[model samples]
Target chain A: MPVTSSRPVCILGLGLIGGSLLRRLAGERPAFGYNRSTATVNAAVADGYDASSDLPQTLTRAAETDAVIVLATPVTVLGPIVDAVVEHAPDCLLTDVVSVKEQVARIVAHHHPDARYVGGHPMAGTAHSGWAATDPSLFENAMWMVTTHDDTEADDWLAVADIARAAGSYVVPAAEDAHDRAAAAISHNPHVTAAVTAAVGAGESRLPLRLAAGSFRDGTRVAGTAPELQRAMLEANSVALLNTLSETIDRLVAARDRLRDHGDVAALIEAGHRARTAYEEVAAGEVEPIVGVTIGDDGWAQELRRQAHLARVWVG
Target chain B: MPVTSSRPVCILGLGLIGGSLLRRLAGERPAFGYNRSTATVNAAVADGYDASSDLPQTLTRAAETDAVIVLATPVTVLGPIVDAVVEHAPDCLLTDVVSVKEQVARIVAHHHPDARYVGGHPMAGTAHSGWAATDPSLFENAMWMVTTHDDTEADDWLAVADIARAAGSYVVPAAEDAHDRAAAAISHNPHVTAAVTAAVGAGESRLPLRLAAGSFRDGTRVAGTAPELQRAMLEANSVALLNTLSETIDRLVAARDRLRDHGDVAALIEAGHRARTAYEEVAAGEVEPIVGVTIGDDGWAQELRRQAHLARVWVG
Candidate 1:
């Protein structure tokens, strides 16, 4: 609702996140869409989206209006998307909805120094993917991580923040490297952990495996995620994930040793009980939400530090 | 119905399982309920249960009526319950509803030679515990593991099986050692692994912990379980769990190495995908139900082995 011109918002890649972003921005702004699929683009155009017949035409219209370009493609296509956008729409403000942030931010910074690109990642998704599975309310009350490098422009940051807020998310400002590390620990590392736990527990025998009912099912639900997608995310952030996973395994082995050597797993159980309690408290809205995160203001960053302390939102 | 007298079914502990068993037996047969909680005993009596004033009186009346005694208590209480039941109702066919089957089965076999005891473990329960949480439909279509040692009598086994069937469960025949091993892999091992995972994932840094939403929460729901209860279960089956956890860690490390060195995690993802498919197949009722598990026949055991292959219900 903040003051802005009538420049259109163009979203590339009609995938789940892109489609969702387009649908959620309905009526808020003039939406232009592009994708690898012609049928999908036609479907969007039929639904009243401003559709260009091709990427060149779309980029031409967007570059004319100094539009906001949202890159919603996969990780592998990120570099190419940035290069294309810089070549065709140098005046446009750019951002991304990628899972991994540091590499994307660095690549953007190197590829087009004149273009202002804010790295954005919405901390929400389901096991499903593709345009058909897009949910307009997917970002409702979700944490939308907006990352900034040393050369990030304040105006560009605010523009992306406006879109994220409009999409019904709380803006969480983090450094580029911090976002990658955090994603590894929370999303990528635990993902592999769940898969590995289920696999080893599955074992070669079937008798005990059948007994893997409620608890194992709940513990390893993420293990059923599409393999190809999981592989990309895990390997993309392998450095941080490998570190977190090694430490996690060490901690688990220690717990195992406690049980085997001393016949006591009280310490392990107690620690889990404490951590779960803390997490539940936050989930239940027992902590205040972070709102209107300031980009470059010293006092604003200080306020962010205080909020992270109170809300338990640390810089990973 | 089977040409039996008016002998009652006596449930010794009146915990969740015992209470549920008594409630389910209502109108099908006369029920005699006993528990340490005199208040719970009175509540059951008020609700039309044939409640006993005390343990000795309960046992004496049960023995006089030729009752089938079900010892439903905590793991620590199993041995004592068996001793007391044998002392009072020596002629009755007895069984138990303990979580860990092998230890309880072995203890019952060693303590009282005259009493025919069939080891029982119902693979179902909520986060709630005790008499208040009892549900008559708790075991409806649930897997009820009935364990047998060499000394177990066929008549006694069938008596327990009849009760299990009446309570609406698929009676699965397994050796005492087999039941323990299966429970360790499926139930006990996965349980501790969840707790340990949650513990490690919930380290002091709040950044990543806050980002751990659905996947982490789903993976670690068992971590929020009561500390003392988890402690007892994890400690009780430490040997099997330690072995399983070690293997799981090794597999995870292999996946980590794959991600770090070769930039591949398909092996980890594939293993998880395969295991999850196996589990989901059974869960969706794709696998045939365990029917007519043979007791002692050599060909019967062979039939069970064949059914394991056909039904895809292998030993874990």
Candidate 2:
């Protein structure tokens, strides 16, 4: 059954992700958004989004509606945002889109136990930020990873998946620690590597770097990401991130040692070749597709045919 | 004085670089391009270039012309190609467009002591290969790093620079060692890193990768590079490349350690910020442009004045 409601959906924190969600939801539902900055709220309003800078008014409005409140703030701000949402929207289904999950899970467990809350981290973003940089397609084809703790309700987890599906993201279920470790390996560590490479090259000849064309520019592009947020993510998921970093360092060291001792350049090149081949295999779909796949089996096909035949007989 | 030339230019190995050079030179001077493949020679001829599959005819024609012979083969093939070019174009100034300088320099010294061979590596390439990928603008805005050994004549070195400039590359002078190190740091090692990152990610899950939107795809896109050439480069510059890779890994490890120890994620992020800031500073011409800067200070000021004058000139 469709849980149809005319009440507005309230989004807390009108940053890039929040703004984007509001922009998409406004087409279907009565959407309202609140940000700390009045200027940002005014800009959003001017851009045809129903938004306000008044947090109290926003929370009050959220409490009255059968709306789901989404906290789209940084890891540090998540706890406080959840507290505020709990005080205001006592009956609302609370959710957060913070990258780190353990801390958020703990916070919800301690404070907002009465309110249903699900922790989500959508694996998507650009190097840019703010409401101006928000795009509706940002979440499209993205993995919305949800982490469930012992305190998380089954109903709330399902609701979180529904929200992710509605936002055009494939729901990926993972434990808090597992998600953090995986994220560190792929995303967090890579960002740090890019930054360090840029730093080392920058220390060398600044002149040659300026002349750096496509490859260098693209490689270090993510180094331009927001400092404070990156720091928070690193701090929040420190242990896992450090482990991945160590592994990466060891790989490089091994390559270096082989070059110094063996003089076998071919072996070094083969490593790179193997890596590239593996990556291509994944990208080309020679391996399993990451997103969900719907397969209609022989039994399903037979059932469909039988149903079609029955329908045809009834029509005749 | 322009060396009065009755002799045609001989281009050995008519691949993309060689074929492009042949096509360009055919329009301006009498040129002969030799390819091992009869089909390649026929195709070049059909494309209106003066090319031959017959080695003796090509060598005899090369000997007859006061031609400069250019070797445009891979590093492994450079040794034999140099021997052939030395045997044929003894009096002609010889050059090459090989990526590595040290190996080519060593080969030229050992086999072609009598030939005027200046080592050149054009920092320009497309992902594609073959004669069909040849473009006139291939060398445009490219840095043509030239290396001269002790035996190289000043006039021969000057001739190579003149060719590079005419082909639209700004020639930069460097030692073979320096060029190799720089190429390893910027080009070779980075390719390996991209390849490894891609491979690791691919090994984990192809589905998540396919669902990988912009940033992940863009970051690892270079991993799709030709495995054979990528490996060859790694092998050739293994020592220098390993050093670069080690340095990069150390920085990444340090950043990760700081995060792990809960030392200060903010500081690490700040380091990243500083690194990116430096990169931008270098990129924006606050530092010297990598491809040798064309405009002098006086010329730049005059150009600015000229642009202002043009605005006034047009208005008036």
Candidate 3:
């Protein structure tokens, strides 16, 4: 129940993730939020939630209550939001729910170097956005990645992890750089690939689209996400995404060459089949969690990251 | 409802498509099928369905009844099945529900050049296959493509289309080459691309696998389909798929280069977004169906192909 603290949680922004976070935290702790749009604020308030349009007032109240300030805006808009946090609630334990961790960490460091900040990214969302699309159960059983570094404060990490767990997520501890790379491999690159695949169908005229069925729809599903949102995440983590995208392109080239030259894609199909089997094993709970890693003990970061590399979850 | 007579329908190979087709045709017509595996044959017979392991006797019965023989096995096994059909049911009206149209068209021409043949490719299936995964409702509201060639007889074409309509699907008429090319763009190439994408995540450490969420899962869902089945479809359509696969790789390379050199993916993302939106329009019933095309009229093949090219359906 998040340590039962009276130090309220303050959320800035009320789009899908932020709005959903505000609703999810309603009974767990004293939480209030601010959105840039007054209509969304009014909508939340009319629904009996503590939402406001005044960012300064929101941060001031949060500061006075010794709150945990959560920055919940797009990566492109994080600069001004971080400046607001620096001005009014610079001393609060800070966290964020952005998609890219390293970029958010850099924004926080640039805005207020001395601010007690912990980076967070909940690996959850849908194609929809805005407060109207928000649902309190959005994070239920999702993975919320809490980033760690050599100098990160253990207490601040625990505070954010507690909230993430309270919101019905399994907290995954990762380093900022590692999280961005992993996100690029699993999320951001696939978004670009999906977009490319979808554009191919569209470019082929409507005949291909009419013949399109499950594979085309499934492979290109993420391409339907709002474009600007996709840009924010993909551009924010462009470095890691480039490497992964190139590797993926190389694999395709090899498969193409094999098909053109030898008329065989046996190696490619076999590799993919085996990989999907491994994922099924892990998803079906065949991989056991690694126990005995105390959250605050010395060398815990190394141990936890090791557990993640092996696809094992942390029990604590 | 289908030009009712004592004529029966003979299905070869009671796998997913054939088994499901046999089930779907139960009350509509007199149907019987042959499967190579006695186990599946026994299972169907025990369930009171007309299934047999004797290919010679099955084809003999089909020949005597002036049946329509549906070749439902994978493309790799189509040679032997077509040979059996030629040996016993050479005069029967023939069709197939294979994934690729032109390949089966070539096989039929090779095995029985004078046979009454109309190629079919049903654009509906789950990732799962085989007898156990058979569903009677599999083809309900699905698109079943009926192929046309220069020498195709109108009665033969209508005969196959009627059976496909009876199986509960919209009948789309396309030329043999056009159907294979369209399938390559939408289905066959996507299978190869999915294999590459899934292998990328698997090639990475288990961390990426653990972090794989919606986009990764959706993009790679078909990669989990039976590898042998994937090979059958992909290999049979290799010529057309190579062209489509090459174009897809070019798009990815361009996106990757843009991301690497200019740190910009706006062009790529917008193209994909626009394409997906276009697809949504068609799937959402926004595109009006083309009317006034009389089936089997003069120039009807050209007209229907044009309608399909414009992403319009033929109502009658």
Q: Alpha-carbon interface RMSD of model 3?
A: 1.3
lDDT of 1 at A152: 60
Candidate 3 lDDT over A1-316, as tens digits, reads 2444455899998899989999999877899999988899999999889999999999999999888998898888888988888899888888999988888888889988898988888888888899989999999877788886666777787788788877887777789888888898888877887887788777556877877888989988999999999998899999988888888888888888998899888888988888778777766665456567876689877777777778775534
What is the descending TM-score order? 3, 1, 2
Q: Flag regions of model 2 displaced more than 4 Å.
A: A1-8, A147-159, A162-166, A265-316, B1-10, B14-32, B35-56, B126-128, B131-137, B148-158, B165-168, B207-215, B263-272, B281-316
Give the lDDT of residue B210 in candidate 1: 62
Backbone collision tally, model 2: 6
Steric clash pairs (candidate 3)? none
Candidate 1 i-RMS: 2.2
* lDDT tens digits by residue: candidate 1, A260-299: 7898878777887787776676677643566565556655
- Report clash pairs, candidate 1: A206-B314, A206-B315, A206-B316, A207-B314, A207-B315, A207-B316, A208-B315, A208-B316, A209-B316
* lDDT winner, 2 or 3: 3
TM agreement with the true structure for every prediction: 0.88, 0.80, 0.96
DockQ of each: 0.56, 0.30, 0.75
* Candidate 2 lDDT over residue span B1-316, tens digit each: 2543333578888877787777666666677788888888888889888888876677767777666777886677777776776666667777888777887778887887776677887777655667888887887766676664444455666667666766676665555776677677666666656655544443243333433434445555555556666666567776677677777767666666666665565655676678677657644532222331232332432332233211110000
| Proportion of native contacts present in model 3 | 0.76
* Cα lDDT computed for each candidate against the true fold: 0.73, 0.64, 0.84
C-alpha RMSD by candidate, in order: 3.9, 8.0, 2.0
